[model samples]
Target: MSERANAMRASILRSHGGPEVLRLSELPAPVPTSGETLIRVGAAGVEPGLDVRTRLNGAGWQLRFPHVLGASMAGTVISSPDAAAPDPGTRVAVAPNISCGECAYCRSGRDNSCAQREFLGIHHAGGYAEFCSVPTRNLIPIADSTSFAVAASTAVSFGTAWHLLVTRARVSPADVVFVVGAAGSVGTAAAQIAALFGARVVLGSRTPQNLRELSDEVRALGVVDTTTDFAPQLESIAPGGVDVVVETVGSDTWAGSVDSLAPEGRLVCCGGASGGEVGLTLRDLYRRNLSLLFSTSSTFEDLRLVLRLVDEGRLRPRVDKVFDLADAAAAHAAVEAGGLQGKVVIVPESAA
Candidate 1:
């Protein structure tokens, strides 16, 4: 497809700790095998959870990198042999989950629940470089209406939100949804998705910038606010406690997320950014019919369904910053600061 393949680029890994570990290094370009497709990645996601996992010594994630960082990407299919399933030159979104496909869950369309599942950036080489490879089956064709950057940013974040809201939470019109960390990519998607289902959307974050940066589409859904106190503030707004909470802040907001839940409200958790331990009251747990659901990457089917909404203008992704794939160190520093209102992206070998 390309005149040539395999070029060097920057990648990161902290020496001791912090964002500095992310250093760009020269590495070989990626090549796709027979059943695989070679994607000349145009955009790669730099998510907070990705940074945390990378910093935590791999944290049991399926994708790996002492060299690359980025679990998700969007790019054009540069090369795919006729034997490939997705076809060549298709603009596509890279699904994060990597599986055997013959697993029970995979056969049942529950690949996210596959016991042997491995995510892209977490388990294998991810999109932080100029090119990445995947089985043709993992890509869903992107319409002319969507851009490569848009396809790249949606995979893990939006797909996960769809599974939590539509599949597990079963959000309804009567529900009052409290989305913690409301400005982050996934948090923002969760809020928007729930609102689309007719649920009342309520947002909370630590900064006014979050309230300001994520304000546009969130305003279209419902009320947006910055609150430091979770219980009182949520109660003042929702009154009877929230019916659902999409929490990724972890221990920092755990009590607050739980406190704000109504009797039968459920909390769907996918990350733990603020640390993991929390103080809880057993009486509250037993008396309230609160449910806690945990999930990982989404299936291609969920990605395809969600992307249809994006193509139709019902869902729009937020991108805060862009960096060359080699400048992942800068992206990590920005992420660690905790102020970005949207997902950061890395472009490989295309710019300074």
Candidate 2:
């Protein structure tokens, strides 16, 4: 192969700040090391919360310049030296979370909490390129029928939602669940998962039009316009209060989320897109008997389960838009603009 053929096109962040920082350039394609598989990236999901934050401020995580910033991706395997790894040409979804298997959290199936966990895009070169080198263990084979865009979009949002609703909150059929920021990818996944579990799901969004449309699309039990005071609106939906609150929008909706919960209610938070810090009242927590929980990324099991669901047609992963590799900067700008109903995907030019 010629020198240029050996190189790949990638959107790299040389410095941090606005969407303009991401530039398309030729970088040497990654070579798979022992136990790692090189993949030709087909699609990479753009997470508004994570990607946007990482682009704007590095998300408080230490970074090396010329970083690639896609957290979740799906692609076709090229080659792997490890015999146990999937064969070349296999379609797969790359799991973003990498945890040491010997850790107690991994042994207990709670790998998302592993102390030595690392993330793609943040800690390593990611899929915002024509190729990526991923650990063989992170490669989960996807069905031939699953589109790269859909598979790339599933792991982060759906797995996180599953972890929050199924594992953290333990939502039940009798539970009344309210999902804040229902228009975003994670929020939409959370609402759908809660509903599938037979919970009465309510949707909330600051964009009234988007909220109303999403409620109708998801067939949520009710809707709450987050532009104004939503506590009273939620009160009418569930009478006293909801049994579970899926809080992804942080400070902006934190107080209201706590206030909208019923006695013995559970509030599971997975993101802080709006802001992180929030004040709490000791009296309110003790008086209502509320359970506050926080979840990070999802475990391997969560990723597997969600992927199986999507493959089986039980869960539908939405792709809001697709941009070629060169347009990654615009993709980030779109995500930051908000009001998107589904995930925005970045497709490498070669794949497109």
Identify the leading candidate in terms of TM-score. 2
Local distance difference test, each candidate: 0.76, 0.89
Error of 2 at 153 (Å): 1.1
Candidate 1 lands at a TM-score of: 0.90
Per-residue accuracy of model 2 over 196-234 as CA lDDT, tens digit each: 898888998887577665676667878888878898888
lDDT winner among the candidates?
A: 2
Displacement of the residue 119 alpha carbon in candidate 2, Å: 0.7
Looking at model 1, report the run of 10 residues with the lowest lDDT sum: 218-227
Clashing pairs in model 2? none
Error of 1 at 183 (Å): 1.6
Residue ranges of candidate 2 with Cα displaced over 4 Å: 1-5
